[model samples]
Target: MNYNLKYYKFGLAIMAVILTFLSCKDKVKNKVSNEEAAISTFTNPLKVEFGDPFVLDNGDGTFYMYGTGQVENGFATYSSNDLVNWKFEGRIYEGNIEASWTQKNFWAPEVYKFGAKYFLFFSADDKDNPNDELENFKIGVAVSDSPKGPFKDLTDQPLFDPGYPIIDANVFKDDDGKFYLYYSRVCYKHPVESEISQWAKEEGLYDEIEESWVYGVELAADFKSVIGEPQLLLRPPLEMNDRNAEWESRSVTSGEVNRRWTEGSFTFKHNGTYYMMYSANHYAGPNYAVGYATSNSPLGKYQKADNNPVLQKNIDKGGDVTGTGHNMVLSLNGGKKMYTMYHGRTKAMGENRVVFIDKMNIEEDGTLIVDGPTTESIPKPLEN
Candidate 1:
């Protein structure tokens, strides 16, 4: 073969590849409009109805929000360029379809852009209730090629059930390239002998009380399974005298229900301190609220913040917002600003969960604070 002829053919092939790359880049630019209509401010109960709202800030300057109650037996997504306006993206993951392993009561869908693909971690009941248990909730994973997804489950099974119901899956990737799966074990069948339980029985509200606890485990590289046993990360205090216990047991003490929740956990590291933010109390009730704990490691002996219930219903303080929990932190503009994406209820719209985005920050003393559950119009999330 002539050397000149071979070199000419190689050069032609390289030019074809470059042209294809530029063509695709142009298409990407046209795909997202990037919110030409600027928004200087936004109000609470963002026009989108979502319980347990999770916002994913894709590196390409667009954000996608996913949550519960937006779809039936599955999940839906909303896309946004500015944090103020959102466009419904329709159902991304639907369970209960033929051969689907998960079914009704879908909740808390958190998506992450891992490598070239987006992965969604969510929870729902088992489609096949082989045991016929009352609550058969479990965590499941789905994958998509885009942030606005047609995400399909990776397998026809729940992601490694811990012999009980679990929900509110949050996947975290550490600096070491290891993945960690954090979730809340359901209150179902998890009865414990605690002051709250005894008080519930004494008050004749219920014979026994169940409490949800949060757990964390190292996820396998492929995300197909767990690397080891789940470690108990956080749970409601067994002692009523505990500081956080008071806020956490409002459901039982208020005589609304007979359960305590330590669910809706969102963990992230800020300034070398691993902060795990979690919710407590019944999610559908007024007492549902958020708190945080800090640890030196991803999974460890965590200490709850002195400012317990950092974000709670302002009703007691003469405001309308309630049911503010299941929070996922949104880091925008390359982490220059941070906000909490959670669900809440207004006095006029009781029991109907809606989304709330509020600023959160760390104090000089390292206290994690969520200045949220606000009702009035607030300055929109900082895009820069």
Candidate 2:
């Protein structure tokens, strides 16, 4: 039977099986290594000048980010899967003279998925009233079938002008299936004789400065109309409380008199509590910063978080980061982790701003934490 010959053949078969198994294992290991490498190396100032950045996840593993730009006709967007690499999606809304009341000053567009449609809320100057001297900015809504949208205006006018200027519209949907809109009521024509203005004038800080305030209101199901009176959410602190007065007062220090801003409101619910984040000071100045408030309900008698200015420029650390504000928060890894997307200026770039995403955490005491305004590279969000 040639027993030695049979044993030799058996040995060759066993060696072949082991070699095949090793080859498969190497392939799998290399594939995983490549994926990890791709996911970990995201740089800051994400490749685009996205002022007042708003990022929306379509529940389809894709993210679309919108912000202020010089799109003479409409608004634009950028899309990404990994949140690190972005591709421009072009102008998603071009003003229709026949259907739109506004023709210029388009800024800060944010999109949300509602029912079977995606709604885009944005700010622009109303062109309807020629005699109006302010040329006031107002928020309006448009709709599309896809997240990457060429949205059509839902109506021919602004969503319900509060008899004054309003801008930076943000929409939030609560667990009870109700929708709310948060926005900035700009202080353009408001009396400069107010207490804050007087204090500034007396200090020689600068005069004729009015402050922007954050406001919120419930929206009808169609999102085309406001359901109730607007509720004031936040305003710049007139008195310096802790470090808030110093941080939020950067505009005054930077020579932008009467320019305390509390605009760009974004809302998210975590652990049954509602968090509202808003930006302060002039957007173009280095003093721009972000702060938050908390309440039990969406339309809150919300109180400002004592740990105010949760995100701001880190100039004391001595890097090229400044003017950090106008942030949007997104839940990642099935709501286990969160990230804040915002805009900031680098020393090399001056007033020019670029988009950034950084880790956001909630503390045990319900204080919201933003681990950045960082200039260093960071890891991308977990893939769905």
Q: List the residue pairs that clash in candidate 2.
A: 209-258, 261-281
lDDT (Cα, tens digit) per residue for candidate 2, span 1-384: 699999999999999999999999999999999878767766688888879888888888898988898367678988988887899988889884777888678888998887789899999988876666565788999999987788999988889988888899998888888889899888786543445556678888766677788888999988778997998878776665444667777777657666777888899998999999988888887778889989998888788888878888788778778889899998887888899999999877778889988999998889889998877756777642
Tens digit per residue, CA lDDT, model 1, 28-104: 77654433323455678888888889888887778889988777778899998887789999989878888678878
User: Over the full model, what C-alpha lDDT does candidate 1 score relative to the true structure?
Assistant: 0.87
**Whole-model Cα lDDT per candidate?**
0.87, 0.83
Q: Alpha-carbon error at 298 in model 1, in Å?
A: 0.9
Using TM-score, give the best candidate's number. 1
Candidate 1 lDDT trough over 10 residues, lowest sum: 31-40
Candidate 2 lDDT? 0.83
* Runs off by more than 4 Å, candidate 2: 1-39, 192-196, 241-243
Q: Pick by lDDT: which candidate is best?
A: 1
